[model samples]
Target: MTAPFIPVNTPLLDGNEADYLAECIRTGWISSEGPFIERFEQAMAATAGRRHGIAVTNGSVALDIAVHALGLDEGSEVIIPTFTIISCAAALVRAGLVPVGVDCDAATWNMTAEGVEAAITPRTRAIMLVHIYGLPVDLDPILALARKHDLKVIEDAAEMHGQTYRGAPCGGFGDVSTFSFYPNKHVTTGEGGMILTDDDALADRLQGYRNLCFQPQQRFVHEELGWNARMTNLQAALGVAQVERLPRTVEIKRRIGRLYDEHLAGLNRIRRPVARTGYADNIYWVYGVVLNDEVPFDAKEAMRRLGEKGIGTRPFFWCMHEQPVLRRMGLMRDESHPNAEYIARRGFYLPSGLALTDDEIARSAAALKEILA
Candidate 1:
């Protein structure tokens, strides 16, 4: 008989998640305003090496809040990876800032400093450095460029919870950084996110944005418009537990990557994700592989075949320039991001969730090799 299907990802909630959640329920502190909420925020900020952490309902809303907190004028340009999730661009657009798209590094699949430099213009007000997948972007040059250009750096470290650059943490470098506690991430809060920053004023603004911009002196009086994106105490309970287990989660991801490397070593029709020499080891956020030109099929076709064998996979993000929503808005009208387009068409990730077992990894790798062969 065939084995049960392995999923693309699954949340690991075996830690203190249940205990903390039960405490929240027993204490009747399940709402947005509760002890767990503050504890989670502080713990998350400390983990990311930031002074403050403002919890929000989800990753997309976290991005929106971070962008608005910058207070950039309408039409100010923010450089972003063309290969990132739509949340990056959408946040900037919603805040009345123009998003300048740049392609990723062919090897790392993360945005290059060269691309950021090439995309910069006088209207450029900031850089949204999205650390794609499990690896942190090459940030030294980007930080130097921002310093030279007086540009604000917003690090979207959603995919890089426990990942680092050099000796520093991913979220620690940005002027204001953000993280998602989505189920697939290293740490999960079910459906939650947090904005991290060292600046006192920016942290204040972030809190205001997440809480409907309530005036401190006058309760229910609003000084400016904001969203009700506050994360509940129940989510915070989960987050606190998840954050405590981040080190182990990262180890599991690396182990899965190594297993894939071992199992898929002889497959010549595909190229595996890169782990740069100087930076942190590629934690393999997902065990993605890119089909070489020698392969007769595209990623979609390869994925279909794998699915037939009961293996789950996910396609890479489509380039922002090719997105129909952005196209309709007249953005990236004539721009072509070759690398981003290539990766989007050719790359797909295997099951690399924290909960994945050795047996699942071996089975998934064998399935991929068979499908490609």
Candidate 2:
């Protein structure tokens, strides 16, 4: 038996991270509104080709701010991929709007432009495009559709830090975008998030939402009822260090992804992920393999078997509209997202973090072959 453990995720921090955190503490501005925060926001904005980037507590809050900044009123609808983190749908719901879950494209596993068109109603106000598992969702068609329909486009780029779609960065393409800087993300700040936008007004509104809607002009003036969702200078310091190192991290991820593609091919039960043509860029946060529906095994069984081999893996996201909490909102009824359902049942992610040693990857791959063969 292979010895006892492979973690599903691990933080990719070691060099200079502790020093940076210490420097932030020495500076005594660890809470908020400090030099590191400004620096991080600016650096991220530049990376995304956006004029503004607002730091927030987490990706969920970033999504909430993005939704609120759009000015969508009650009963307004937001179209989102059903196969995504529940936070994407929950953000829209929290903003007093309706979430219309749409099916994903069979080939790319992202929102299909045709599906978006079919789901849009007169009440539709926006479309939130999620770049799942680091792959760029096909965006040109979706952007064109948004323009034609005059709908706002919000990008959930939490899984795609350096990914590009047709030469444009993932977070740079939408009207507004949100990013998660969780410990496992390509570049992390412990527990932080960012909002990137070309719209100055939206940026300002999001910043306001991050700080309890406190007026910039008056110290304690409240402009709107908002949550205290703020990222600290310590987190920003960590972010600055991580962002500076991201180019190398991205290259490492791509190299690993290609290796997985090459080595895992021809395995009977596994269907490798394919990067769509005309969309070459990706971050490879999680490398996925779809289990064949006819294989007589499901995700749960597959994961359990892998676990017994000391191999760690996780199932894909359950379709958000099918979740119990969202069901009470009446958002999922009369809706069936076949692709999302299929992936949820047959998909699981491998250990693809940048820090995974090559030997570990080979060992894991060997274990997968043993089980599948």
Write down the TM-score of every candidate: 0.99, 0.96
Residues 1-373 of candidate 1 have per-residue lDDT tens digits of 9889888998899899999999999999999998999999999888888999999999999999999999999999999999999999999988888889999988888899999999999999999999988778999999999999999999999988888889788888878999998889888888999999999999998999899999879969887999999999999999999989989988888988998899888888898988554777897888888999999889999999989988889999988888899889987778789999999999999998888999999999899888877
* Candidate 1 residue spans exceeding 4 A from truth: none
Best TM-score among the predictions, by candidate number: 1
TM-score of 2: 0.96
Q: Report the lDDT tens digits of candidate 2 across residue range 1-373.
A: 5475877777677657788789888988898977899999998888888899999988988998888888888889999999999999889888889899899866567888889999999999899999888678888888999999999999999988777787777789878998999987987997999999998877778888888898868959886877798999999999988888888888888887788776787686777777555676556788887888667778888888888888889889999878988888677777899999999898998877777877767777887887777
Q: Provide the global lDDT of candidate 1 against the true structure.
A: 0.90
- Candidate with top lDDT is 1
Global lDDT for candidate 2?
0.85
